[model samples]
Target: MGESRERLWTRDFVLLTVCNLLLFLTVQMQTPTFPAYVKEAYQANDFVVSLVISLFSLAAVIARVFTGEALKTKSSKILAIVALGFVAIFSAGYYWAGSIVFFLLLRILVGIGFGMGSTTFPTIVSNVIPAKRIGEGMGYFGLSTSLAMALGPLIGLGLLNWFGFGSMLIVLVLLVAIIFPLMHFIRAYNQLPVSSGNAQTVTGIRRFYDKKLLLPAGLNFCLSITYGGILSFLALYGKEAHIENVGWFFLANALAMVLIRPFSGKLYDRKGHIAVLPPGAIFVGISLLLLSLTTTESLLLVSAAFYGLGYGMIQPSIQAWMVKVVTPEQRGMANGLFFNSIDLGIAVGSVLLGVIATHSSYSVMYRWSAACLLLFLIVYFLSQLAAAKAKKAAVASENVGV
Candidate 1:
């Protein structure tokens, strides 16, 4: 009975994780490669290159609104299938992209599909996970995403170099296509809790965006901004710095993420975000600083390890914190909003950092990325102080009445 009460590794959860892993793997593989591709193929500038990531991300943010609403009462099966359809079809469409504009269009359409798939998988998993272990389960679930982010670029750049862009797209297309059959095994699609978010009295824009999720969502946004810079320019930066095997940064980062994720997730569950976030942010900030100043492969990889450690700790804490604050019904919106923050951050970071790189250098741009996290720390501490004051006031009021 006790085992069942805390079961975090059910079949449903595993399948969801795999589907999400594949979905994101396909997406992240393109993240670092596309900028270089757009530059070479289209003779594009930094602004146009920024559009490749930002515009696609904004489209996904808008699409997730509909996805969140649909998941409230509709069949998650239908949403998942439609999302897969968009991905498989549009991914193959990349082969026909004769111009950069056309390719950006494809990215927009596919991101909508991504928004649907990304939201549905988490909503279903949030239900199936034993409520007692939401942090651990989500941390494990998050591994699928972090791992994809970690390894996809190394594989993507390899495919681009060894074969060609066309062959790389073909591989990613097949990778995405594989997810279709796996959907049949997901049995938790229809099992929703009775106390869903729809029961709350939220109205208008608030219906889709919850106030409770704002602070963590903001912090998550800042964390993703640093990564956004990495995704948009690391490949290009490799050339700028004359580094031959920059993919090693991602490989080394992946190793660190793999080692740290389990322990960080358990720490969040036992001690809360206080035990995890600040130190993790410090690791991320230091990594970006070191990466900016690094001139050799050894130093580059050391920076990657620091990043992986911080990112491993911080990302899951923000995600689990959002999930814990909302109702079962609102989990759809929570997940949607959670992802929206990430995509939006990526979008903003890509453009902002792209401009910095245009005028200065990628190294300078990374320093700016590190500085953005200062906003994260400031927002987090302010929220904590407010909560503490509110708690103190409540206690004082109760004592006077007594």
Candidate 2:
């Protein structure tokens, strides 16, 4: 009976999860603080600071395009190791970046490593888990990022205050270095079948991008724009507002996401997007709106909680939806495309919203972000309605033929 049962936990899975956690920790640790670093270090303006953040996403997007296409031919294990090496190397480069141009170059390199590593790791997880439990497994896999998000910035900020920026860089380098040895233990990398999609026949850009995954990807893209605003500017916002405990926003956000994630995936597996997307999007919208109005520490915390719950529910649900809808062969591409959308959103959000904040105020920028989420709801519903119509038409034709 035990042998007959599907396994969710394995040594490889655990190691990969830890590796993912470490990788994301390196990324998240700098999310709220990198702009500050560029500002203090280079005396960059808001546009320049936002560019630093956006460049990472842009590089990640470009890297994923190739990463997705290479999944079929590349050894994911090797890819992961190499990517981690780049991450560690560039992470240390932070200490040497004396100019804005040099720092931007390092950020791009870091994103490239991160892009390849992120794609490879998730594909490896998909291979290791029971096919029937993709949602649950991915949800659990996602916990690494969630936990990192919760803890990374808090740790980064603390280190910055207690020690210095150089200390933070050293710690990120160490975190990436720790994962290097662990990658050797992951047995699932070469064991599982690559996605069923035919990579050889599809040449050029089509090989890297998948259109089928667009809906959820689009939704994720929209939501992540708001998230970019939070990640890139929230610390600055707190400083401007005279709020001392701005970190609480991320704390509340991360905790809520962790609490909801375990079950949110299960909900998606059982009931589909209707059970998750609309409610999740609504929560996200509300959170952005709340953030716009936050004048007190308590209000900021409340906005954080709402944003956490909203983002937590929507992100995994969209991911699971992307996986479920695609053929096993397409999982790599789907994952790549899905994540590409997320990075694209972050890139666009950081640049666009950064401009808005420059011209207007952060409060105005957040309110506009909240308004954009309302458009997410509209897009989601329209997509669902169109999908429903297509399904009904197909069903009617089938019945008539029968």
Error of 1 at 393 (Å): 0.6
Q: Residue 363 error for model 1, in Å?
A: 3.8
lDDT of 1 by residue, 1-402 (tens): 988857888889999999999999999888778889999999999889978877777778888888888888888999999998998899899889998889999989998999898999998998888876777788889889878987787789899999999999999989888888888888898797668535656678887978889899999999999988987788788888888888788778878887788888888888899889999999999999998998889999999999999988998778888988887777888889899988878778878999999999999999999997777788888999999999999999999999
lDDT of each: 0.87, 0.84
Predictions: Cα RMSD each: 2.5, 2.6
User: What is the TM-score (0 to 1) of candidate 1?
Assistant: 0.91
The positional error of residue 18 in candidate 1, measured at the CA in angstroms, is 0.6
Judging by TM-score against the true structure, name the best candidate.
1
Per-residue lDDT of 383 in model 2: 82
Query: For every model in order, what is the number of clashing pairs?
Result: 3, 4
